[model samples]
Target: MDKTAGEYHFTRLETVVFGAGKVESLGRELSRRGSNRALIVTGKTLGRSKLLDKVKSAAGSALAGVFTGAEQHVPSHTVNELVAEARRVGADSMVSFGGGSPIDTVKNAAWQLMGGRAGSRTIDFSAGAAESGRGGDILHIAIPTTLSAGEFTPGGGVTNESTKVKGGVADPRLQAKVVILDPALTIETPAWLWASTGMRALDHAVEGSYSTRHQLVTDTLATKAIELLNAHLLPSLQMHGDDELEHRMRCQLAAWLSIFGMSNTRGGISHALGHQIGPMWNVPHGVTSCITLPHVMRFMAEVAADRFGPIAQGFDLRFDPRSPRSSAVECADRIAKFIGKFEVPTRLRDVGVPREEISRIAGTVLEEVKRANTVGVEVTLEQLVGILDAAY
Candidate 1:
C-alpha cells in the first residue's frame, strides 16, 4: 500500500521486550544502560509487591532508593517530591514499576530532571506542541504492571494540584530507554482495575484506527490489537493460577500494539472525555474510558463508519458495511456488554458522577483536552454535555 504524505514521519520507543518472565532481565538491562544508581518509582500498593522487591533485589547494589509515593493522577506536589528524592539519592537513572500513574510520575520527574519547569502556570494545550529537542541526560526504564499502554508513548499526564486538572507533557526525552513487559507482574493487579485498563487500551486501538491522522501502519496495528483484546481480555479477567500467564501476556501485547498505533495516530473522543472527567470525579482513568467509550463511538459513527466494520469483524460480529452506522452501534453495544461482565460500572452515576457535574465536566474538556484532538468532528461544549447526559 502506498503511504500517505507526511504519515511516515513518526517516532517510537527505543526497546520493547514482551514475554512472561522478561522482567527478571531488568537488572542486566539497567546495567547495560551504564547506570549503577537507580531510583525505583511506583505507587504505594505496588511498591510493596513481591515483584517490585524482586526488581530491587535484582538491581542489588545498582538500586539506590525506592520512592513509593506515586499517585493515580500525577499531582504537581507529588512530582516535586519525587524529583527531590531523585536528586537526594544522587540517582543516575530511574525505573517506573507499575501502571500509568507511576509511569507518568517517573516520566514527569525525568522531564524535570532534564530542566522542564512546573508551577502554578497551566499548560495551554492549544499552544503546547512537542519538540524533538534533547534535554539533560537521565536514562529511564518502564516496567508496566497494568495494560493502560502509557509505557509505550512519548506523552505523560500530570495533574496540577491547585486546579486539579490533568495536563500532558509531550517530549521524546520522556520515552523509556528500555521497557520490560512481564505478565508475571500483572497477576497482583486488582481484577477490576486490570480489566478496566485493558478496556482503555482497547479504546486506544479503536479510536486510533479511525483518527484523521491514521495511516496504513497504524491501522494494521490497531486492527490486530482489537482482535487480541476480543479473544483474550474477558478470559484474562476470569483466569487463575497457570492460565493467567498466557492471558496476561496477550493483554500486554494488545496494550503495546494499541499505543504503537496511537502514538502515530493519537486518540479521539473517549480519551478526551476521560481526561475531562477523571480529575473532577477522582474516577479511575480506565473507568472513565469504559463508561464514555461507547457513547463516543455512537457520536462519531457517522464519519467513522468505514473504520468500524473492521473492528466489528475483529470481534466476530456480523458486519455489513452497507449498514455501517448500525454495525458500529452493535460494536459499541457489544463492548459495553463485555465490560459489564466485570466489576466495572457501566453508567456515569454508577461511578458517582452526579447529573449537575456533567456540564462542568463538558466545560473542562472543551477548555482543556479537545484542542489536542484532530478528529475533524468539530465537537462543541453542548455535544460533550450530550455525551455526558447519555452516559449518565
Candidate 2:
C-alpha cells in the first residue's frame, strides 16, 4: 500500500464545552456571545422534562421564549412556524435542546429568518455549498441530549410534507455558534432513542471512514469513534452504576468524533437513502441506519473492501488478512450483531416499511444521488433497489 500525506480542512463550532454539568454554563455562554434574547427549540417530550427547566434556569431572563414544536425530519412547515416563533419572541439567539430534529429545525429556520435563503431545502452538497455563502447569521447554541451529531455539521435535512421527501442544506453559518455536551442533559433520553442514535453516530463513523474523500485525519477520528461507540453504547443503554454518566459522555464524544472532518467528505448510500427514507417513511435517521448501514456496507464491500479494515479492527472482527473482501464482510457482520444487540429493527419490514415501497425509495435515492453526485460509490437504480431488497 502506498501512503501519502493528503490535505483536508477541519471546521467546527466556535466553542465547545464538554463535561458532566456544562449545561449550567449556558447563560454565561450566551452572555459571552452577546445574546440577550434566546428562544429554546425542542420536542414536546423534552419540553416537558425537567431538562428544559434546567436550561430555563440557566438562561434566566435572557431566555425570551420556548418552542417545543420540533418534530422528526424537520418538516418545512415546521421551520416556517418556528421562524414565526423566533420573530414573535424577538429571539436574538436560539438554543437547540433536543437531538437532530430540533437542531436541524433551528439551523434551517434561522437560515431563512436571518435572510440567507428561503426554500433552500434541497442542499446541493456536490456544489461545495458548505464553502459557499448560503446560511444565516443567527446565533445557535446546540445542547444535544442524544447521540445524533447534527450540531457539529452545517448540513440540515428538512422534509417537504407534500412530497414526503427530505432535502438537505449545507452552509457554514448553519453550524452552531457553540455546542454544549453535558451528559446530564441526556439522562432523560429514552433508552431506545439513546441506543438508536448511538447507531446513527456509528453510521457517521463507518460512512466517514469509507467516504470517497476520506482523509487520514478524519479516518483516524472515525475509527476511534467506532471503537468508543462499540465499547460504550451498550453499557450506556444498560445505564449501570455511577459511571453511567461517563459512558454517556464517551458516547457523546464518539458522536462528535464521528463527524469531526465530515465537512470535507460526505456519507455514502446509507446516508443518502436515510435522507430520503427518513421523510418518505417517517423513520428517524438512526432507524434508517439500523435498516440500511449493514446492507450498504455489504453492497460496497466488493469495491471498497480495504476501507473497512479499520472498522473491522474497531469491532474486533478477525478475518483472513489475505482477503480484504472477507474483512469487509466481517465488518458488516459485526455491525449487524451490534445493532441486533439493542433489539432494534435491523430490517425494513421490522420497521413497517412496505416491501413495495423499495422501488420508490430506490428511485428517489437514485435521483438525489444523481443530482448531488455526493455518494461515494457509483450508484444506480438497480444497485439502490438491490440494497433496499437486501435490507427488506
Candidate 3:
C-alpha cells in the first residue's frame, strides 16, 4: 500500500502479557532473562495497596527495593532520587508497577543508568534533551493499572519543579521491554481514576486523529480505540464487582490502541497544554484530558473537520444536512457530553486553574512545544489562551 503523506514508526514491545493472574509470571520472566536485582518504581497509593504485595510476591527475590515516592508529574528531583537508590541497591532491572507517573520516572532513571549523558541529573525540557535521539540498554517492565498509556511510548515526561514545565527524553530505549495488563490488579483502583484515565485515552485517540503527522495505520488504531472507548468506558466505570473483568480488559485495550501510533506522531494542543498544566496545577493527566480535549476539538473545527468525522461516528452521533465544519463542531459537543456522563469536571475552573494563570499557561504551552520540536499543529499564545478561556 502507498503510505500516507508523512513518515511513521512504531515500537513492537518485546513481550506483552495480558489476562488475570498474568502478573504472577514476572519473576520467572526476569529469571529467564538472567536479571538478578530489579527495582520497583511506583506511586504511594499503589505502594500501600495489596497490589504491590502481589507484585512483590511475583517478583520474588528479584525484587531489590521499592520506591514509592514517584509522585504525579514525575519531578526531575524524584528521578534523581530514584536513580540514586537504584545505584545504591545495585539493581540490574526495573519494574514500573503503577500509572504514567511511575512509568515515566522509571523511564528517566533507566535512561540515566544506561549511560545517557547527565546520569541522575535534573532534566530541563527547555534544554532540548527530549528531542535528542537517545536510547538506553536497561530492561524495564511496565505493569499498568490505569489507562494513561505512557507504557506504550518512548517519550517519558519529567517535570522540573523550579520551572514547572514537563519534559523528558524520547529515546526508543525508554520503551518498556515487557507490559503486563492484568485487570484483576486494577480492581483496587478507584472508579473515578479508572473513568478519568479512560477519558485521557479518549483524548489520545481524538488528538491522534487530527495530528498532522498521523498515518494510515495510526488513524486506523485511533479510530478503533475511539469505538472501543465509546462502547466500553462507561460500563467499565459502572463495574460493581470482579465479574466485570471483560469490561476492564476492553478499556485497557482501548487505552493501548489509543496511543499505538506514538512513535510516528505527537499530540497537538490538548497534550501540550496538559503537560504544562499538569505540573503547574498539580492535576492528574486524566483530569487534564477531561478538561482540554473537547475545547481543542472546537478550536480545530475549521482546520480539521474531516478528521473529527470518524470520531463523531464512533460516538454514534447523527448529523443533519449541515456543513462539515458544523458537523465537526457537533463532534466536539458530543465529546463534552460523553465525558459529562462520568461526572468528571470539563472546565478549567472546575479543575482549579485560576483565571489569572491562563496567559502564563498558554505561554508555557508555546515554549514547551517549541522546545520539544512538536510538529503538525501550531498555536499562538493568543489562540491557546482563547482555548483556555473557553475551557475556563
Candidate 4:
C-alpha cells in the first residue's frame, strides 16, 4: 500500500491537552488564545450534569454565557440561535462541551459568526467558501466527553430541521484551536454511550484506512487507532478499577488518531449512509454505525477487499492475502462481534426503524451518493436495501 503520489492535508487544530484533570486549564487556554469573552455551548441534559459545573468553574470569568440549545443531529435552527447568542454575548471565542452535537453546532455556526468575510484562508469544500467566507476566523475550544471524534475534523454534519436532511460545513477555520481530552471530564458519560461512540471511532479508523483518498500517513494513524480501540475501549468501562481512567484516556487518544487526517480522507459509505440514517430516524451516530458498518463493509468487499487485511489484523484476526474477500468478511465479522459486546442497538429494527423505511433510506442515500460522487464504490438502491435488511 505504498503510494508515492498523494497529498497529506492537516487541519487547523494546534493544541491538545491530554490526561486527567486537564479541564482545569480551560481558562488558561482561553487566555492563551487572547479570548476574553467565550460562550459555553452544550446539549440540554449535560447542562444539568456536574460536568458542566466543572467546565464553568474552569472557564471562570472568561465565560460570557452558556447556551444549551445544542441538540442531537445539529439542527439548523439551533445553530441559528447559537449564532445569535455568540453575537449577543460579544464573545471572542466559544467552547464546545459534550459530544459530537455540540462540537458540530459550534463549527456550523462559525460560518455565520465569521460572516464569510474572514474565511479567505479557504475551505477544502467550496460550500465553506460560500457560507463561511475567508479568514478573520475565531476558533473555539472543544472539550469532548464522548469518543465520537467529530471534534478532530473541520467538517460537521448539520440536519435541516424542516426536512431532516443532513448537510455539512467544512471550513478549516472552524476546527478547534484547542482540544482538551481529560478523562476526568468523561467519568459521568453513560457506559452505553461511551461504548457506542467507541464504535464510531472504530468506524472512522476502518473507513479511513480504505478510503479512496487513503494515504500512507493516515493509514498508519488509522490502523493504530483501530488496534488501540480494540484493546482499550471496553476496558474503559471497568466498574471497579483505577485502570478505568487510564483506559478511557487511551480510548480518547485512539479517537483522535482515528480522524487525524480527515481533511484529506472522508469516510466512505458506512459514514455516508449513517449521516442520513442517524438524523432521519433520530438514532445516535454511534448507534447507526453499530447498525450499518459491518454490512457496509461486507458489501464493499468485492471491490475493496484487499484493504481489509490491516483491519482484520488490527483485531488480532488472521488475514489471508490469497483470499481477500473472505478476509474482508472476517474483518466485518470481527467488527460485528465487537459491537455486540456492547449493549447498544445493533439492528435498524432494534432502534425503531421500520422495515418500510428501508426503501426511503436507500433512496435518500442514493441521492447523497449522486451528490457527493466519492463513495469509493458505486452502489445501487438494491444493494443498500440488502445491507439494511441484513442489519435489520
C-alpha TM-score for every candidate: 0.94, 0.95, 0.91, 0.93
| Model 1, residue 58: C-alpha shift (Å) | 2.1
Those runs of model 4 whose alpha carbons end farther than 4 Å from true positions after fitting are 1-3, 116-135, 370-375
On TM-score, the leading prediction is 2
Better of 2 and 4 by lDDT: 2
Q: Is candidate 1 or candidate 3 better by TM-score?
A: 1
Q: Scored by CA lDDT, what does every candidate get?
A: 0.79, 0.84, 0.81, 0.83
The all-Cα superposition gives candidate 4 an RMSD in Å to the true structure of 3.1
Compose the digit string of candidate 2's lDDT tens values, residues 263-329. Answer: 7767678888898877888788888899999998888787778777668767877655578898898
Pairs clashing in candidate 1?
A: none
Provide the global lDDT of candidate 4 against the true structure: 0.83
User: How far out, in Å, is residue 91 in model 4?
Assistant: 0.7
Model 3 TM: 0.91
lDDT by residue (tens digit), candidate 1, 40-109: 9999998777888877886777899999999987887788899999999999999999989989888788
Candidate 3, residues 1-392, lDDT tens digits: the string is 64546655656478888888899989988998788899999998998898899999999989998999898898888889999999999998899998899999998887788767533222233222133444436788999999999999876888877878776676767788889999988888888788889999998888877766676787788878989989888887676666477888888899999988855656677888888788888889899999999888898886767666557667767644346788889888888988999878788899888889877867768775554443445667888888888888
